[model samples]
Target: MQSPPLIIGTRGSPLALYQANLVQRLICEVSGRTEQEVIIKVLQTTGDQIKGELKYFGGKGLFTRELELALLDGRIDVAVHSMKDVPTVGHEDLVIRAILPRADVRDAFISVKYDSIDALPEGALIGSASLRRRAQLSVLRPDLTFCLLRGNVGTRLRKLEDGVCDATMLACAGLRRLEQENRITQAVEVDMMLPAPAQGAIGVEVKRDREDLTEILAPLNDRATEWAITAERAFLRALDGNCRTPIAALATLDGDVLTLRGEILAKDGSLRVAQTVSGQVSKTLDAYDLGFKMGEAVRDEVGGRITFDD
Candidate 1:
């Protein structure tokens, strides 16, 4: 009656715009409305404007703080987010209304000179801001050097070709969404480097108690992806994982059994721990416990000196 009174807020980035447009299109279709009937709002977040290593910020919701407040204040009807930046069992006011279908859950190595991470020569410079990527890179190729690099997908790849770095790590899904998949010389397989929890997934956030919005968003939810993240995020939350710490997790579905693989590395990337678990979807919490147990085991393997940068 009031034109659905829907306003979708998202970060102002190429990828964010793309994801928001998608949700906008779907909402328009389902609600029997036109694109003009929906409103799109862009907000700049602390995580988006920051130019240095993300470790400096208190991890989780670094990119969605503004939008979260918007939801709380009813300035916007809903928010779109990349779920990896979200906290599990945390965040007071906003609620994740739906987790859209997941994407390719692997990191892609884009370089004009190299085909894969191992293919790069010794002393090669790898550009990435994620502690998990840095630690794992160090373990696999101790000769490689990691410098703090932050920017949008296009900006990072441009820097790589501009000689700022020999190679850069990015979400494979992001590249593909922008129709630049050919730039991916090699996609880091899950076995080689576990991806972040909720990587390559898009999530819709809305205020709790908004049943009308929830009903509208429920159609986009993917049950398998939802369950997979249930295990992944649970593990991350249990380990107190954050950007300052090097932690990676991934989950896959094989029929009704979900397999979760997780890894944790010390700051220098010297100490590492890895493990895997399989369980039913209904046993999601049990699977999550297995991952946290593995992380705890890793911490024991590394001792308490695993330096998570201050």
Candidate 2:
């Protein structure tokens, strides 16, 4: 029997389309399906509709729920997502079947007038929608002020060029995927600015009922990146992090060892709680355990210090 064409769901942004096309090519290669056998479904999400600050609108799942609904209704066979946009909570019936290899897991500082973060003058205006970035950058340069800049990679850069702010921050991975890496003035080091959990990863989500598709995507999974994200996300899940909270985590693997570092900061960047945990992970589950423990420790250390109200 001939299998039906595979429909891939994704946001309509340039970066989203690029990611979807990449996944489409990979799926076709693995499943021996021709280009015509695959379809790309561009779906508009709430996040795309909101021109105001994301925090004011529905935050978590803002960019994902519509596509997820499409998946639930079988409108699409699979959904391709930027893992960072995905909420920390898991969907009961959906599973991330594959995660592409990690990208440059660092923030890119883009400024037309300044060469780098250090070059920016005090009191200069900066733009970002990520609370994590604002908190970390505020701590580094308390004199700077911020304006809300929210959009896809191209839009943000265009705004920067039009003098939206003195500078802006973006993920290096997004620029690379969009073929706009040349716009990055400086790739901020992880030490200077810790990235969000699973920041640079691309996750392929599928309804659990689709076993055949799962099998096809299994070969695309990068075990190392998967475990690394597992650790990072486990830390996020343990903290119950949301857009309101400023939380950041990163995990790195070397041989059989996994190390996770997590941070929770006050909105104003006044107080920060950070912790690091490392363990020998002969199995992937070990990374999850390590991250959970680290998260718990950080939470305990900052008890009642700052709370992100629901």
Candidate 3:
């Protein structure tokens, strides 16, 4: 009997399609399946419909729920997601079965006129939809202002050229995937701006009961990326963050050691709290308890003045 085709679901954006296609290529390579064996399904998401700021329409899960529903309904065998957009908590019946190797975790500075963030004159306006980016940029250039710029990679770049703001910020990974890296003015250093938790990773989700499919996709799982994402997401989970929340975390693994850094900034970027933790890798690394502890430590230091929703 012939093996059944594997249907992969993803949002219809160019970057999303690129990620899904990457998974398709990898799956075919690993399973020795033909391109015809893996099918890509383009699904619409609530996040894609909202015309204004994302915070208004429920942020974190909006981009992922439709594709997830497709998985739950058995309409697709696997769902590929930008891990950063996935909620910190899991769906009842679905689990992340694999993660592609990580890409650059740094934010990229993009502009048509200005060459870099620092080169922009004081009081320059920056365009972005992420509270995390806004808060972090505020720390570096408080004099700068921000306006909302929502949509896919192509849309944002067009808006930038049309003068939506003096410049904009985007993830380097997204640009690279979209083959728009040439448009980046500079790749912001990590110390200058720590990335959102799991910023540059892609996660593959499947129904919890699909052990067969899980095994087939297992080879694509990068152990280092998995360890780092587990830790970083733990930090987000502990902080109870959504996209509206100004929270950032990044984790790195070197040999048997894992190091994680997390940050929470007030929406206006006036107040911030940051923390870091390092540990030897073990079975417990997968548990991500260290990241949870780190998040709690920062939360305690910041107190109740934060308005995570706005």
Give the alpha carbon lDDT tens digit for every residue of 1-310 in model 2: 9877899999999999999999999998998898889989999999999988676776769999999999999999999999988987868999998999999999999999999888999899999988889999989988889999988888888899999899999999999988889999999999999999999999999999888887799989999999999999889888888888899999999999898989999988998888888899977789889988888888889999986764
In candidate 2, list every pair of residues with a backbone clash: none
How displaced is residue 132 in candidate 3, in Å?
Answer: 0.7
Clash-forming residue pairs, model 1? none
10 residues in a row with least lDDT, candidate 3: 278-287
Candidate 3 lDDT, 1-310, residue by residue in tens: 9877999999999999999999999999999888899999999999999998877787879999999999999999999999999998878899999989999999999999999889999999999998899999998889999999999999999999998799999999999988889998999999999999999999999999998887689999998899899999999989998877899899988887899988999988898899888987775455398788888888898888787863
Score every model by TM-score.
Answer: 0.93, 0.97, 0.97
Model 3 lDDT, residue 127, Cα: 93
Q: TM-score for candidate 2, please give it.
A: 0.97
Q: Model 1 over residues 69-142: C-alpha lDDT tens digits?
A: 88888888989888887777656656777888898988998889988887899899988888888888888888
User: How accurate locally, in lDDT, is each candidate?
Assistant: 0.82, 0.91, 0.91
